[model samples]
Structures are given as structure tokens and as C-alpha cells.
Target: MLGAIIGDIVGSRFEFNNHRSKAFDLFTDNCRITDDTIMTLAVASAIMEAEEQLESAAEIGDNNREYYRLVEVLAVKTMQNLGRSYPNYGYGDRFAQWLSSDQPKPYNSFGNGAAMRISPAGFAAKTETEARILSEVITRVSHNHPEGLKGAEATVMAIYMARNGADKQAIRDRINGYFYTLDFTIDGIRDTYRFNETCQETVPQAITAFLESTSFEDAIRTAISVGGDSDTLAAITGAIAEAYYGIPENIKEKALTYLDTNLQAIYEAWQEFKKKRSMNITFRPAKLQEREILFREGYREWPKNRTFEEYCSDNAKEDEYGIRYIMAIDDEILSSVILLELKSIMGKKVYGIGSVLTPQNHTGKGYATTLLRKCLQQIENNDPLIFLYSDINPAFYQRLSFRILPLEFQKVKKSTCMVRCRDENWEALLKSSVALIPDYF
Candidate 1:
């Protein structure tokens, strides 16, 4: 739940006394992702087939201690990274105690801590039912109470609905449908929030905030407006809302400002982790595999196309097409761009690879070769016939399994090459340059 961490970090400042509304900021100088974000990631990382992490931890390395030690290491590292020098965000009393502890002592405090901190289960769950089950199982680690378990379950449900493309009403219905045992209406929460303090009351209330939202940011505002555990409430709601609306551009830009340099990098790490995780996940060990092999292939003469370098670097942050990649060195940008959207070409059933660039001085380094091989390695299924057109050297792509075809091959329906690279294909020539994004204003 990277989105939740971002929300928590951004909303931490306004948690208790929220004044600003609908403002897009990564994290206000005062804001930082809390135990919710850290614990959520840990839970997502710890998942195994055995019905429980504690059980799995107990059975590790022919003994249980290794697993516990591993879990403790992850928790400590995540919590340590949450402080000032890294992400530098907010944390409540019980969490601070856990963070400061050299070893994790199961604390029985069943506050919203368990619920507010669990969003990754939504992403990790294979189905809605599985998500709810995982939510209950994981929350029991520290928060054994029914309310604690309920709060975590509700967060998982919200995250699952949002990621699966459910609208606000759909999310609300799913949340309310399962949480019928609790007084779950927005009005009910707002009316009784003055007296509600436990996980049961707060979790559903936070989710309702998202369920009633019009925009991603609106969910956070709704959570804060109700006023109970404002930051934690918004953290849960904002995370689900972000998955629904997809983080707004202005908000993403501003949020990065509040984080120190290390955590700013952590944002990139989170993106990479999620991207690779989605690509690699399968049911059994026999299915587990790494499909893609991406290489940056750093540049020496980066200034030859300085603007292109900056542009490619900026576009790399949002691999929107899910197949686009850029070349960079250290923090400085570079001059290679390959933004190929791996979709089919109508009738021909050919795999398309249009985003190809070999700008100025960077030409001889075999970027095309490097990128092509990497792309092929990444394809485990579906993208069978790779296509591209190159007159300068058909031999280059030919080495990478691409074949040269006649100009009229477009009309011939061949499934071989990745692209029918036309001389007029200026959009494909440069990186990050899109000639046709129909309604993109």
C-alpha cells in the first residue's frame, strides 16, 4: 500500500487539526508515513501459503527462530526507516514502543493501529474472499480482539475493491455488505465518532470516508473531517482512494517535497517492487519465474541530448504503459528512451515495439540490442511475434530475432516482427514522445 504511506505522510500534519482541504502534497513538512505504511509493507512481504505468518515463522530454517528473526529484522528496518532521516513521518504511542523495541513483543492494544496499517493485503489477495481471510489472520498477530480483526478486514476489503476497478458505491456496498454487524453508515460514524475510539468504530468510519469520496483527495478529507484518529482514518481511506482514482499528478509532485532524499528514493523502490511483484506472482513454485531482463546501460556522453535525458528520466517515474523504460545514470539523466506499449496489432496478431531511440553520441552502445534482449526476457506469454523496421541495419534487430519485411507487409498480416518501423514514425524514434494520445490534454 504505497498509496497509503503517501497518504499517511501527506495527511499526518492535518491528522488532529486538519485545515487544508484538497491540496496536493506528497507530505507536508510536518507529515510522514506512519506505522500503518511500514506494517502494511511488512505484512505484504511476509505472506506465505501456510494460513499464517506466525506459523510460517515458526517453521522456518528447520526451526522457527530464523523466521521470527527475519520478521523482526524487516519490522525494525521498516520502522527505523520511518523516522526523521529517512521517511520521517508520524507514529502513535504503541507503535513508537514497538519501533523502539529491539525485539517485537506482541502488544495487546487493539487500537485502530492494526486496521489503519493494513492495505497491502488487498493487493496480495488473489480474490476478495482471500483478502478478507488474510486480513483477519494477519491482524491477529498483535490485535487479537474482534474489533482489531474487523478493522483490518475492512481495510483489506476497501483496497481490494478499489484495485479491482470498483466505483465508490461499489466499494461502499462491499464494505457495508460484510460489515453489516457494525453501525457502518457515514452518518452513523459522524454522529457517534465522539464516543467511538476502538478499531471496530474507526476502521469502518475511515473506509466510509473513501466510499463517499468524489476524488482521491476527497477520501482523505472525508476521513479527516469526521475527526477520530484523523491521520489513521485518512491513511486507510486515502490509500484505497488513490488506487481508485490513481494518484493525481499535482499531489504526487507535492508529496515528494516533504520526504527526505532517501524516502524519495523509497518511492521509486515501492514502484519497482509493486511492478515486479505483479509481473512475477503465480500459484505454485513451478510457475514462479522472472520474465523480464531490463538493463539501464548507462551513458558516458549524456549532454549530447540533455533535454531528451531529462525528459526520459521524468517519464520513467510513471511507467504508465507498464512496458516503458528509460536509461539513467546515478541521479543524472541519460539519452536512451524505449516506451513500448506491449499491446496487439489488430488482425496481424503481432507484438508491437514502437518506442525505440538511439540519439546522437549514444548510438554505438547497442542500446537497441540491450533493450530488445531485455524485452524478450520479460515476455513469458502472449507477446510472441516481435516486430520492428530498420533500414540502416536489419542485421542488428535480426540478431535479436526481428526480421525485415517489405513496406507493404503491413497489409500482408505477418506475425513475426515487433514493428513495421516507418521512416515517418517520429514518435517511435525518440523516447517519451507520444504523437497520438487521443484525449490527452
Candidate 2:
């Protein structure tokens, strides 16, 4: 949804006059947030209101279909209200007439407006079926035509696929199989394309622009360069681009400046709702019941000559001190790290970092980095010397200021003992036989 808004603002200046090339400044003084952005936020606000109603109705045992019906009514009402609030914004003539009328009705038009404001449906739904349902409910209020519905549904499905880790080829193939033919390229259509408002003429070209692009900004550039219905085209492309390649922070900051206070407030509220929905991943110490889970993570980190149960039972004793930390999203553990306290050797207790493990599927998302930072903070008061043996991903720990110890101090020549501390005795501690250094990365 934010992607749609950003794209609308960036492409607003070139909506009527076409830009033939992809080389143009994204946000400019001539740029403005158009009806697409206003309507998108209106839909998002309606969804948020509907979610609140669903929560209240769920307590009274209302059926799910009843909740959807309420959402449909609220969506229409919200769009009408927001449309009235911004009278002079760039709305289509028919849409402007509908907005001012006491009886605003679906116009059975196959315009691209349906595709521009349907991103929230994709982001909020948990499944493809739910996405289709939400798309129909939201789109039918204004665009009742089949092409309009198809355009909105396709946009939602593309975002759903991209958000769930689908690649570009997979997205293109699925979209092609489900809806229109996407075999055409942006370059093939860029030169000859003209101002087009119909969903059939605009949505597929916008998607093709995304399919041919390298980054989020490039996708928006490609969409605008096609020249027809630039704001809406870039909006459709931006929605998909946001799901696949996240908007850079600087770009997001600049885009938000174009919106007024009311729209920005709605955007902020929607952001908070998204944050609430994504509150699954958390950090905490391992409980006694999860001892086996923690140990299994450790076993994957160090697959030595021992059964899984044996390794778990051996490490279960660490529960007494409660030093085992795991980063779990829901019931599944994604990463684990341990902070083991050593005995007072030279009148000061030392700490050993161990088992910095991240599962294969959950790598490259910073799970291990988050766990390591938390472990360090948990022991920051002691100012203890943190030591670890990292055979894999040594550069990660090195970036966090862990220095490699001498080769003679290591248990194996290939293995490395790394230390991190404010104290000077870390090097001396690494030389001791009780080092029990790390052997896995």
C-alpha cells in the first residue's frame, strides 16, 4: 500500500505528458499525491476499521461472512468520505461524479483504479483464497466489471507470491497462468504506448514493467517510462516492487512528505497495524520444556559423535543458570546462542560465547545477529571477556569486534579462538587449557 502511495506521488507529475525514458528524478517539486494515493489510504483505513469491528463481533460469536459484509460496507463508506475530503485531486470524471452523488454506485467500468488501490488486500490476507475474497469485496464497490476485478485480483496475487518468497520467473509464470499473457517486454511496449485508462490496457503493461526491472526504483521507472496512465501504472508496479524488493529507507522518507496530515495519519495507523500483526518473532531464555529444542539447535551447530538425545541431555544442565537463548518466531526456533560463564580463574569471571546457530531456511535475515547482540547485552554489566571458537562465518563475529587468538591456543589448527572484551586479560584467558574453544561457525 505504501508502495502504491509512493509510486503515485513520484509519477503524478508525468501522468498526462509521458516520459519516454526511465531516467527521471523520482520525487520532484512538480510531483503530488493524486487520487490513487488518497483512495489507497482510504481503503487501508476501511480495512483497519473493519478489523476492529471483526474483533468486537468475534467476541459476540458472529460468523466470518458477516464480518466480510461489514468490511464491504465500511470500505465503500470510507472511500466516499475520503473522496469528498479531497475534491480537487486528479480523479477521473466519472469517479468525481460518483463521489459527489448522494447515491454512489458501482459503474461497471474496467478502469485501472481497481488495481491501484487493491494492495492492502494482498498484504493483509493469509492465503490466496482470502486475497481473492478481499479483492472482490473491495473492488466491486467501485468497479463491478470483470476486467476490473481481474486486474485487482492479479495485483493481489502477485504481491502475495512476492511477499512469500517467490522469484520473478515464478511470479510471471503464475500471473500468466492465472490471468493475462505476460510474455511481452516493457521495452517492446515503451515506445508506442499512449495514455490508457482501462485495466486490460494498463495493468498487464505495469506488471511487465516490474517483471523486466532490477530493483524497486527501477520497476517504478519502467512503469512510468511506458507513459500511459503513469501514476496508476507506477502505483501497480510499486505495489509489487515493495513486496519483492523492500523500499529503501531514504526513498520511503521522501515519499511520505507529499501526503497531507490526514492521509499521513492513516498511513501511520496502518503501519502500526502491520507491526502488531508481525509480532511473532521474540527473544527469551529457554524453558525446561524446551531444553531438547535448544539442544537440537546446538546439535545442528556442532554435529559431533553423539546422538541428538545425548547432546540434549548433556546441555540440559545449562538450564540451571539459564544462559541458553533462542530466537523463535511462533513455536519454530530459527536461531540460538549461548553465554556460558567460566569459573573465577584470576579473581575475575569470564564468559564464553557458543553455539551461534541459524537454520538454513532462516539464514541471511539477521536472526543470528539479533541473538548475538541480545546475548552481549545480557552480560554487558559484568564487562566480562567474551570468547568463542568460530570455524564458519568468522567474518560475522570479526565485524562484531571479536579478534582471533594465536594458533597455538586453538584445539585444532583449522579452528580459531576469538575474543571480545574491554579487559586486557582476554588474550591470557584464551591461552588456558580450560578455554574449551568454539569449533563451529
Candidate 3:
């Protein structure tokens, strides 16, 4: 249900992808969350309060609509709190002031803001009829335009239809009446959508993704394949998909790692809400990757070593796995040192954990640490175990909540040409095992 918000946070940076490839990341230390996240969380807070207020109102037999109105008030207030708390979380200039104080102005700005942030309320509604109604009411607080209302209403309704197990066409037919005129079905979307933006274009496009899928993950991939705002589209789609398909145990499990303690708590609250609705299936009992496959692709046989020029030339190859990583650029040159995603030595399926580096003069300003958290959040999988080679200073890792593992424990039971591959003396070499997590980054 919250997958929509997660999508926005993960996709915030690539809204206008330019020429970069999706293969570029998961980790590195650059990508960051944006206002879509701020606003979505704002809505979630409002929904939680709405639920509480609704129960309170029901006890007194107050009008049913009053409960949703309470939610609208809380939503505006929560959005305002986010502005004051994290002004730099990337709220656009015009909206930032609205988030700062009580005196407010709801924007006529018909951006996807309404659609992206409204998923939470949609899923929170008790029924399809109720979902559409709340969509209209909640949206009026900010996005009151016809198209804006349509976009937000469309997303919430899709999530409602999906959770109830309505088929793709059934859901499509329901919303198509309100938005665009299209005999064009979800299948048409699968066949036609190549790439586009704007809520008018992407919202319906993302809706088809949910309409066409069987699993939450599939819905995400479907949206990603068409491109556009991959994260946002996937997010908007994923929220609905989660309602229909539920998060696969695999994705939800892995997504857990990316969440810091605070995010984790929020996720748990979301789960509690879902449990009240229906049983959800997910990818549980996470799988382990093949060891042989690891030996082949990992650092062992350093891929036909290529210089920077050669590496840059193979853009497609970079997207495949380890080739593309974040870089700090300054003026016309590459600034700061790079954080390499060298092969990971962590538990099976834990993937890679490399260095956390800041470009040259970017040191004391906290850019590297900020980047590390952002990048880590991007790729934090749910394998439950992640290990990394400490950047020379073990102290750095220690600060990030990592405890030093004894070097003797990591050594391979077998040796290479009579030499131990895992250095028994590794602990003597540097600092702690994991790095400290910075406060807000």
C-alpha cells in the first residue's frame, strides 16, 4: 500500500532521466528522496489521524463525511510540518511556503503532486465508493483541478479495485469513464506506452501497469519498462499492486534493509493496516543465489579490464550489473574520490558493500556520508545480512552502527594456492566493520 510512496522516494532523482540508464544504480551515494516523499508521508500521517478521528466521530454518531474532513485537516497540517522539519527535502519553491505555516493556499498547480501523494488515502478508504469520495475530498485541500482530481482519484480507485481482486478490464472500465476516452485497454498500454510524463500522461500509464499485472513486482517492472518517471510510476503502480498482489516476501524482505530504524517503524504501521483488510501473499523464505554464479561475475575474474574510455563506451554493459555507479562531478572535472561497489563478502545474496568516499574538497561538509546513506537506502535489500570491506578506517564503519567482525571468522575454510583468501590479520589492518549512520542523511 505504501509502495507508492517508496517509489516516489526512490524515483525522485530520475524524474527527467535525460540519457542515464536504469542500470546505473541501487547504491553509490548520490540519489536522494524528494517532496513527493514529504507529501506522501504527510498524507499518511493524515490518514492515520483520519482513522483515529473517524472512530472518535463514529462513537458520537457524527456524519460519516466529518471523519474524512478531519483527515483533510490533518493532511494539511502534516504537510506543513514536513516543510518546517526538512525544508531541503526538495519541496518546490511555491509549495514550500504552504508547508511552513498555518495560513495556506492550495495550489492550482496541476502537477502529479496530487496523484503521487494521494495513494495512501485511496488505499485507506473502506470501499471503492468511499475511496473515490475521499480522493475528491482530500485532493481538494491541494489539487482541486478537474485533471488533478481525476489523476488522484484514478490512482486511489485503482488501488481499491485491485485490492478487491477486480480484473484489469474491470478496473480499467471503472476509471476510464472518469478520465480519458479510450477503448484502449490495459493491454493497449502494454502494447503502446513507450515513454512520457505529466500526471495526465503518466498516471493513466501507471494505472495500466497495475491493471495488467499478477504480482506487485511484475506491476513495478511493467511500469519501469515503459520508462517515464520509473520510480514514481512504479510507486504509483506498486501501491495498487501491493493491494492486489501484496508485496512478495522477497521484495518486502529485502526492502527492509534499505529502511533505517524510523522507516522500518513506519513500514510496520503500514503492515498493521493491511492486516486489517485481507490476507496478502509475499515472497517469503528468501532465496539464496548460486555460489558458482557468484564466482563467475564477482571480482575474481575482473571483467576484461578496460580503461575509463573503454568502460564509458559500453553504456549498456554498465547497466547490466556493476559498471554504473555514482560519481561526484565539479566544474568540468570529476571531484572527490569514488565509492567502489567491489564484490561483497557478506552473507550469500547480500550483494556488494564497498567504500564510502567523498570527492576531494567535499570532505568535512558531509557530502560523502550523505551520499552513502542515500545510496545505501536505494540498494538496501532484505537478505538480513549485509557485509562490506571497511574503508581503511574501521572507526568510520563503527560510527555507522557496524560492529567489527573478527578477521579469523571470515577466512575461507579452504585456501588459495596454500594461501588463505580471507585474511586472518584483516582486523589489524584498519577500523570497524560497519560505518556509522549520519543523523538526517
Candidate 4:
């Protein structure tokens, strides 16, 4: 959704005055938030509210139908409220009227607004079917036309696939197979494209702009360069690009300045909402009943000479600095790791992570990765330096932003040592000074 806002602000000035080339400044004084941004945020606000309401309803009984109904009502109310508050921001004639109407209803329109504002659905949904359902529920309050619903669903599907690790070709194939044919390319239509507001004309071009781009910035430029409904086109493109490439920190910081205080609060709340929703797995200290199970699992790593009873007895001994952490789902342990508070080195606190393991059945399901990520988030503060030694490929830890140390700096010979520092200065200090390898791990 931040991607959608960035595209809207960058493309706002170009919507009227078309810049046919990609070489141009991304942000300028002339740029401003438009209806595309307002509507996108409105949809996001609706999703957050709807989810909260659904949770309350779920506590009572089954709320499948109630969830969809809440989204529909909240989307209408939120869009109308925000739209009226920012009436000067470029809304279409019918939509503007709907915003101020005493009793608003779907106008059966096929406007590109549907696609531009529907990116939140893609990010919130857990499955392809849920994506379509969310898109329809949020869209039909105004864009009840078949083409409008189709445009929104296509955009949501692209974002869903991108965020879930689908490659560009796979996303393109899915969009092409289910929604749009996507027969035309951005280069082929750049010179001939004209200002248009219909979903049929806009969604395909926006998606093509994303498909051909190499990065998030390039995607925004590509969409604006095509010369038609620039803000809406780029908003659609940017949403997918964000899901695929992720936004750079610099770009994200600059984009937030365009939003007002109210909108900024909404954006911050959405960030927190997403974090809470994504980390659904429980992370806690292992229970007494699970200790024997974990001990048996840990014994597999060093079964050469130690018997099961010996290993269990050794592990049961209490250590002052060591604590066992586990990731579980409904009382079933999925992954486990031991965290050690090592002695500080050069006045800097150091932590060690070891014995990371996931059951064979849960190996490929990302349980271990989730556990490690949660652990990092919980302990990255307090000016601590975290280290891990991986007997497997170092690339897996690298993806979590852990930097691999040199051979001479490794805690153990032939073992890949990785460090997650608090910042650049901490990393520089670690690199320049002696390596602090914990004796326990």
C-alpha cells in the first residue's frame, strides 16, 4: 500500500502533463497526493477495521458471512468519509457524487479507480480465493460492474502471488490465464496511449508496466511513461512491484512526507496490524512436558557415542545464561532453538543462537525461519550483537540480514559464522576487533 501511495504522488503531476520518458525526477514540489492515494488508504483502513470486527464476532460463533458483510459496510463508510474530507483530490464525477450522497449505492461503473484502490485486499488475503473474495467485497460498494470487479481481482491476484514468492513469469501467466490477456507491451503502446479512465483500458497497461520493470522505482517510471491515467496506472503497478521487490527505505521515508498527520497515523497503525497478523505462530519457552520430546529431537545431531539417557540428563542440567525457545501451533511444537547470553566482548553484549531444529514434517514449512525471526525481533534492541553458526548453507541466514564473518573470524573451523548487528557501527566494531566466540555453543 505504501508503494501505491508513492506511485500516486510521483505520478500526480504527470497525470495531466505526460512525461513520455523514464528519465525524470521521482519526487518534486509539484507532486501531491491524489484520489488514488486517498482511496487506497481508505480501503486499507476498512480492512483493518473489518478484521478487528470479525475477531470479535468469531468469539461468539461462526462469522464467515459476518466478515464479508463487515468489509462491505466498512469499505463504503470509510471511502465515503475519506473521500469527502479530501474533496479537492482528483475524484471522478460519479464517485464524488456518491461520496456526498445521502444514500450512496453502486453505480455499476467500470472505472480504473477499482484497480487503484484494491491493493490492500491483495496484501490482507491469505489465499487466491480469499483475494478474489476480498476484492469483490470491497469493490462492489461502488464499482459493481463486472469489469470493475475483474480489474480489482486481477490487481489483488498479482500482489498476492508476488508477496508469496511467485516469480514474474508465474504472476504474468496467472493474470493472463484468469483475468487479462495482456497481449500488449508498454513499449508498443507508449506513443499511442491516451488519457482514459476505464478499467478495461487501464488495468492491462498498469500490469504490463510492472511485468517489464526490473525494480520498484523502474516499475513506477514505466507506468508513468505510458501516458494514460498516470496516477492510477502507476498505483496499480507500484502495489505489485512493492509485493515483489519490497520498497527501499529511502523511498519509503520520502513517501510518508506526502501524507498528512491523520493519514500517517493510519499508515503506522497498518504497519503494526500487519506485523501482528503475520506472526501468528507462538514463540515461548518450552514447557516441561515438551522437554523430553525436544531432547530426543536434539539427540539426532550427536548420536555417535552418547546414549539417549545420557544426552537427556546432560541437557536437563540448568544453565544460568541459556534458555530454550520453541515455536508452536496449538500445543504442537514446530521448531526449537537454544539462546545463550554470552559474556560481553569489548563492553558490548553478545548473544549466541544454537541447536536450531525443526521436525522432519515441518522442515519446509518455514517454522524455523519464523522462530529465528521472532527471536531476532525480540532481542535486536538493548545494544546486543547476535551470532549464529550454521553447519548448512549460510545463504539461508543471509536472507534474514545476517552478515557472514571471514574464516579467521569464525567461532569454529569450517562452520559458517553469521552476525546480526544492531547497526553499521556495531558491525564495524565487530569486524575491526577480535571475534567473541562463546565456549558453550
**What are the lDDT scores of the predictions, listed in order?**
0.53, 0.79, 0.54, 0.83
lDDT tens per residue, model 2, 69-133: 87689888898899999988888898888778888799997899999989998887644556778
Better of 1 and 3 by lDDT: 3
Q: What TM-score do all the candidates reach, one by one?
A: 0.51, 0.66, 0.55, 0.66
Top lDDT model: 4
| Error of model 1, residue 12, in angstroms | 2.0
Across 84-179, the per-residue lDDT of candidate 1 in tens digits comes to 232334565665666666665657766887776677667655445556666765666567677677777878877865665444544555565666
Model 4 alpha-carbon miss at residue 346, Å: 54
What C-alpha root-mean-square deviation, in Å, does candidate 3 show against the real structure?
A: 23.1
Better of 3 and 4 by TM-score: 4
Model 3 alpha-carbon drift over 4 Å, by segment: 18-32, 54-63, 182-197, 274-441
Per-residue lDDT value at 428 in model 3? 29
Residue 239 miss distance in model 3 (angstroms): 1.1
- Per-residue lDDT tens digits of candidate 3, residues 1-441? 457755654555556662133244432244455666656766777777667655642221123657667777887887787557667866656667667646876777555677878877666664445677777777877677788788888888777666544545546666776675545444445445554545787788778767666666667656665556666676788788877667666556554555556555665776675565333322111112322222233322233386544533442342344322333332211111122233333332333334233334333433333344334444433322334444246555433334455444333222110101123223322343422211110
Spell out the clash pairs found in candidate 4: none
RMSD (Å) of each candidate, 1 decimal: 16.5, 13.5, 23.1, 11.6
Number of clashes recorded per candidate? 16, 1, 17, 0
